[model samples]
Target: MKPWILGLTGGIGSGKSAVAQHFIDLGVHLVDADHAARWVVEPGKPALSKIVEHFGGELLQADGQLDRTALRKRIFANADDRRWLEALLHPLIGQEIMQYLARAQSPYAILVSPLLIESGQHTMTQRVLVVDAPEQLQIQRTMARDQSSDEQVQAILKAQASREERLRHADDVLLNDRDLAWLQSEVERLHHFYLSLRGGQV
Candidate 1:
């Protein structure tokens, strides 16, 4: 049987990872989209070969792996390239995500993605969970954690779905303006809620 999928998403620095970690600690399987994206482009994968063919072999490192930093610069500058890359990668990533979900033994598994809403991943889930914070806090935290410039972080936020749009799709919401202890407690509430929904004793 397909396990229930609890899709978790948030903007940069909105604490999606922190919330997902709490769920992970409670034994929920984590099928991370970012990890699946990378997996689809591993050295032996067909997706990697297609990327190298289209962008040139220089996109590969001396070790014959993708040079993600270089590719990010190119794609960000050109919309056509971005679309082409997305067309190549998204399907492969989706397959990997489905495979992980199939093997998960938890009452449910969480598919954690920054682009869950924008990439249409929420359609595959039983519930959409948004980890949200104010836009300013998102900017501040992303700048600190990623060592990114304000301009860079702001650009990323611009490309993502607006905060309102994310909230509009949420079946559950985690407001992450407080400390870690508070976040953990809220996660506990949601954890039990999920268990209850699945008809399991918690």
Candidate 2:
């Protein structure tokens, strides 16, 4: 049977990873879109050959791996490039996500993606969970964790869906302005809640 999928998303630095970890601790299966994206473009993948063909082989590293940092800068700076890359990769990533979810042994699976709403991946899920934090907190946390400049973070924020828009689509919201203990407790609470929603469960 197809497992119930809970889509988890949040803005940059909104503690989505931490929340996802808690769910993992409780034994929920998870398929992360970011990982799937990377997988689709790996060295032997057809997607990598197309990228090298279009963007030139200079984007590949010494080990023949795609230089993701260089590719990210190129795409983010140009809308056309961004659209082209997305068009090539989203379907492949979606297929990977579905395959992983189909193999889930848990009561439910989580599809964790930063772009769950923006990329329409939430349509595959039965519920959408949003992890939220104030914009200032998001900026600060991202800067601290990623060592990114304020301007870089701002550009990423601008590219993403607005906070209000994300909340509008949410079936559940986890406000992550609190401490780790509180976040873990909330994850545990939601885990049980999700288990209760299983197809044959009362």
Candidate 3:
């Protein structure tokens, strides 16, 4: 049977990864765009060579790998640079994600992407799940998790689609401002819902 594909998205530090992990624990296959993004740009990959050629070697670490910190700073400092990078990387990431989904073996698969809404890839899925929290909480969590400054976190948030925009597209919303138990219950409920949908019981 073709697996049911769910596009899971959320603002930075809204516990999207934690929620995806819950699905993984429930035996749902997972395809993470961030992981695919990283894989496509690994040292020997074509994407890496293209990035080095376009952005120059300054964006590379001593090991000849992409220096994410340097690249992030450069991209955030200029909209044109950010768009240029996205134009190059987004298609590559999308291709990798599609490949993973094609081979997914579980009853259903979850595609976790921070840019799912903005990139329009959510259209490829049967369900759109959003992990949501207040902007202040999202900012705090992001700063704490990444050890980034408030300004940097805000910049990243500004680059992403707003909470309302994401919620408008959601088929399921998981409020992650509370405790893990609540998150677990939501995940379990959604798992069953997705299974039912896949079984033509929707």
Candidate 4:
């Protein structure tokens, strides 16, 4: 049977990773685009070869691995460079995601992607679940978690779709502003609901 796919997304620092982990603990297969994106461009991957051809040898470390920090600095500084990198990586990431979903053995699979809405990939899911928090909270959380400066956090947030835009696109919205216990309960409820929808008693 084809596994039902749930596209899970949120703004940076919105606790989307926590929500994804909750679903995973409930036995839902997870295909994380961030992980797949990295996998596709590893030293020996075809995606890395394409990237090297386009971006030149300077983007590589002395050991031949992709220099992620260098790429990040370049992409954020130049819109054209960001687009160029995305064009090369996104399709390869999509292919890997599809392959993972095809091999999933669970009742449903969750694709956790920070850029799911922005990239227009939410259309691929059976449902869209958005993990959300207030902008102030998001900024604070990001700063704390990533050890990033306010300016850096703000810039990253600006690069993503606004909170309102993501909420509008959500079939299910998880407000993650409270304590972890509250978030846990919400995830449990959602898990049961998902199972019920799949014709299983939860």
| The best candidate in terms of lDDT | 2
The lDDT-based order of candidates, best leading, equals 2, 1, 3, 4
lDDT of each: 0.90, 0.93, 0.89, 0.87
Residue 88 shift from truth in candidate 3, angstroms: 1.8
Candidate 2 collision pairs: none
Instruction: TM-score for candidate 1, please give it.
Output: 0.93
Candidate 3 lDDT over 1-202, as tens digits, reads 9887899999999999899999999988899988998999999999899888888989888888899999999988999988998899888888899889889898888899999999888877888889999889999999889999999999999989988899999988888988889889989998887887863236
Using TM-score as the yardstick, the better of models 1 and 2 is 1
Better of 1 and 3 by lDDT: 1
lDDT (Cα, tens digit) per residue for candidate 1, span 1-202: 4568899999999998889889989999989999999999899999999999899998999999899999999998999999999998988889999998889898888899999999998877888889999889999999999999999999999989999999999988899999999999999999888877762212
Candidate achieving higher TM-score, 1 or 3 = 1
Q: How far does residue 114 in candidate 3 sit from its true spot (Å)?
A: 1.4
CA deviation > 4 Å runs, candidate 2: 199-202
Q: Candidate 4: how large is its RMSD?
A: 2.5
Candidate 2 residue lDDT tens string, 1-202: 6678999999999999999999999999999999999999999999999999999998999999999999999998999999999999999999989998899999899999999999999988888999999999999999999999999999999989999999999989999998999999999998888888865233
Q: Model 4, range 81-166, lDDT digits (tens) per residue?
A: 89998898888888898898888788778889998988877767888889999999999999999999999999999989988888
Candidate 4: worst 10 consecutive residues by lDDT?
193-202
